[model samples]
Target: MQRRTRQQLRISLLIVAIAAGLGAVFGLAIAGAGDGDGETRAYARAALRGVWTGGLIAGLLTAWEYIYVNRPAGLWVRRLTFLGNVGVRSLIYLAAIMLSIWSGATVFSIEGADPFGWNAQTVIQVGFSVLFSIGVNFAMAINGLLGQAVFLNFLTGRYHRPVVENRVLLFADLVGSTAIAERIGDLGFHGFLNDVYRDLSAPVIELGGVIHKYVGDEMIVSWPDTAAGRSRALQCGIEFHALLAAAEARYKNTHGAAPALRIGIHAGPVVIGEMGDVRQEIVFLGDAMNTASRLVDMCRTLGRPLLVSEALRDAEPSEDGPALEPMGETGVRGKTRPVAVYAPAP
Candidate 1:
C-alpha cells in the first residue's frame, strides 16, 4: 500500500505538471492577443503559479481515489459487493469534479487580480476543464503507472528489438488449487482466486516486483537486473508467504479455507520483446522462466512452500533475512543434469 501510494503520488504530480504546462501555453497565447493591463504580463510570467493554484486543489480531491484503490482491504471493505460500492465510488468522482471546478475559478484570480468574474459562464468553463482533468485521473487510476508506460511504449514499438535482460522470476502458485476449486464451485472459486491474487499484489508492489501475469491460480512476478532486485529477490518471496499467513484469517473467513503460496525463484537472461499480432503485448522469453516454473512445481513434490535455484541461492544477497537450507539435487523434467534446490529456514 505504501509503495503504491508513492507511485500514485508521482503519477498524479506528473499528470498535473503536464496540465499546468498546457494551461500556461494557453494563458500566454491569450495574454499576447491584446495590449493588456500591466498585470497581464505578470500573469503571463507566473503562469505556473496559476496552474499550481488549480493543481493543489485538484490533487487533494483526486488523491483520495488513489488511496482507496491501492488501500489494503479490511474485512468490512472486502465484504462490500459491487453494487454496494459503486454508489460510494460515484460520490467520490462527483466530489472530485466539483472541487476541481471551484479550484479552476480560484486559478482565474491570478496574483489577486481577476479578469474573469464568477458567474454561470465561469462555472461552465471551469466545469469543462475539471471534467477533462478528472477523466485523465480516472484513466491513470485504471491503467496504473506500469500499464501506462507499457501502453505508451507499445505505440512506438519500443521493444520491437529483442533485448536480453538479467531478470529474477518468481513463480508462485496456490497449493492445492484443484481441491479448493472443488470445495468452492467454479464461480465461487473464481472469486476466491481473484481475492488471493489481489492480496499477492501488496507484497509484490512493496518489494519492487512487476506483475508479469497471473496464470489461473499461479502468479508470475519479476524484477530487473538491478542490485536492489537481485538482493531482495528471495526476501520478497519469503515476505509474500508471510503476507499470506497474516491474511489467513480473512481468507478462512471468506472462503472457509486459506490458500498458501509455493514460490520458485530463479535468475538468468531473458529476451524481452513485444508479441502478438491482433492484440499486442510485451513478452519475456527464456528458459530461465521455464526453470522457475518447474521449481515451483517441484515444491508440491518436495513438500516445501518455498524453493530457490542454486543461481539465486549463490547470488550476493542484500538483506540478512532467512537462510536457505540445501535441499539436495533433484531431476528436473526436460533437463538432463539434476538441479540443486534450497528451502528457506523457518
Candidate 2:
C-alpha cells in the first residue's frame, strides 16, 4: 500500500516538472524577442530569468518532497530523508540565485549602472531577495515534513515503549500442561489455554501492567516502579488464580481434570528498551526477570498454585487489594541466602 502511494506521487511529480519546464522555455523565448527599449528589455529579461529559475527550483523541490515523504521503512528513515532534502534544496536555491544575478548583470551593463550607484549593490540586492524567497519556502517544507513524520509515527503504533523499568514481573503457566495435552486432544487443550490467557490478561492491563510475552500457556507481564510493579504483580496472581478456578469449575462439570495454573511474582529494577535491528523487540532485562522465572520453578516444587517474594509482599498495594499469605523462606538456586515467600489468598 505504501509502495503504491509513493509510485503514484513520483509519476505525478515527474509530469508536473516536465510541464513547468516547457512553460519556462516559452516565456524565455517571448522575453528575448521584445522591442528595443534598453531599460524595458533589461527589466523584462531580469523578470523572465527570475521566473524561470523560480519555476525550476519549485519543480525540483516538489520531486524531492515526493521521495522524502513517500519512501521509507520507518520514521527514522524519513527523518534522515528530510535532512538530506534540506541540504539538496539549499544547494538548488543557491544555484538559482547565482543564475538570477548573472542574468541581471548581463542585461544591464555594470559600468553604466555604477555611474548611478546601482552596480554591485543592485546585483547583491536582487540575489538576496531571490535567495530569501527560496529560503522561506524551504523552511516551510522542512517544518511540514518533520511534523508529518511525528504524526504518522504516533498513529502507526510504532512509538509504544519496548520495556518498562521498576516493574513487578509475573510469570504463569498451566500445571502439567504436557499431561493434559496427552489426555485431551491438542486442539481442545489449546482452546483451554487460550481461554485462561484471555481472562488472565484483562486485569493485568487494567492495573497498569504491560503484557510482555506469552510462552505456550505461560505469560509474562510487568508493572512500572517497584511498588506498583509488585502490587500489580500480586493482583495478577490473585486474579489469575480466580480465573483458573472458574475454568476448573466448568471443566469438572464436563468430566475433565481441573486445569491448574502456577504463578510467580517478583519486584525489582529491570532494564526496559527497544532491541533489534531488522525486527525490533521490547524486552525486560535484569536480576528481576531471572528471579521471577526462578520463582515460577519454586511454585512447581512447593506444589503452590501461586508464589510471591518478600520484596513483592512488602510493597504497598492499593486499598482493598487482595491479601497475601506468608509462605516462609526458602533457598533457591543462585541465591546465597533464603528469600521470604508468600502466596495470594484463594
Encode model 1's per-residue lDDT on 1-346: one tens digit a residue.
4655678778888867766676566556544543566565555654654465446545664566555555654334334554444444555656655555456545554443344447644465466655755565544433443452565566567788888989999999988889988998788889889888877777777777888877888888898866678656787788788888998999889987798988999888999888888977788898888889999989988989989998876554435676778899998888889889988877
Model 2 Cα lDDT, one tens digit per residue, 39-122: 555545545544555455555555454545333322343344555655555665566545544553454342223321356554
Candidate 1 error regions (>4 Å): 1-23, 39-49, 73-101, 104-131, 134-149, 314-320
lDDT (C-alpha) at residue 146 in model 1: 40
Instruction: Measure candidate 2: CA RMSD.
Output: 17.7
